[model samples]
Target: MPRLLSLALPALLAALLAGCSGLPSRSTKAEKSVYQGESFAAEETFSRLFDANVEDTCEAARRALLSQGYVISKAESGVVRGAKHFQPAGEVHVEIAFNIVCVGDGPKQQIATAYVSAQQDRYALKKSNQAASLGVSALGSISVPLSSSDDSLVKVASETIPAGEFYDRFFTLMQRMLRENTASR
Candidate 1:
């Protein structure tokens, strides 16, 4: 009987495998197109060409972020990173982080381009209920009816700011700062 059962199991497994072969398979071609950036154009929304050098461009980017209440976390000759926090509701918080890179783009390193990207992170307050328990000599264990909860801010979502107007405004500010710095020197 055991040998008969093993033979039947192998036959059943083969039949199930044969059935799955006829089913349609999912196409990954559609998913690949979602990540394709073939339609990108040089709109200059997230970047700006400057007549100054890379160092000057980076400095301007640092000032631009500082003027808007963003704390500069890292600053270098060609890179800058800053972040700003906001509280839109009692239980919701948001933070916008800015990353800037400046590189020479023209002849003799006289001209540079500054590229900027900003990502927004959202956080929501979460509350969790906890139960209290007590152990006594007479009773094995007793659960108290006291209600206790823990509240914490948890990150909900994060995404890069995709609006053209948002990046355009930031580039405009950087341009203004660059002009001011040139005038001061």
Candidate 2:
């Protein structure tokens, strides 16, 4: 029994040590410094300093959202907020929120960053029934059955768009808005 126990312990220890190698190991100081050379998780900010003033930037942002069918909700204090609700299908509905904040003085220029967040929801049809009582029916006092349906939006998921392409497209559209807004005046 002692001999078998001694033989099995080493094999079990060896197998356990082998499993640890599969995990990521700590890097050496030099190797770690190499990785730190570049930023990995830095937030992608899409802000551009425009030649126009702050008020014009805000107006351009508002007009950009409006042109894209977004309903402007708030426009004050160098911040322009807009939202758009659109239906893609019979039951799927999506709402996108556009928040553009401008910073800097009106005399020189301003920089604005637009953030977009989207939420998707699906509507479900629910059927319900009700019993109604009628004092005087054609024949006698009777009861009637009624059916109704209602839709409720179920939010499945939501997230902030972290892609650069989306922000680039938005900024490009905003640029066009600024140009047009200035052109009109």
Please give the CA lDDT of all the candidate structures: 0.89, 0.69
lDDT of 1 at 175: 89
Q: Model 2: number of clashes?
A: 0
lDDT of 1 by residue, 1-185 (tens): 99999999999999999999877778633456544854566663677788899999999899999999999999987999999999999999999999999999866999999888899999999999988666675776676677699999999999888748898888888889999999997
Q: Please give the distance, in angstroms, between residue 14's alpha carbon in candidate 1 and its true position after superposition.
A: 18
Candidate 1 lDDT at 105 equals 84
Candidate 2: 10-residue stretch with minimal lDDT:
117-126
Give the C-alpha lDDT of model 2: 0.69
The per-candidate count of clashes, in order, stands at: 0, 0
List TM-score per model, in order.
Answer: 0.77, 0.58
Clashing pairs in 1: none
> Which residue pairs of candidate 2 clash?
none
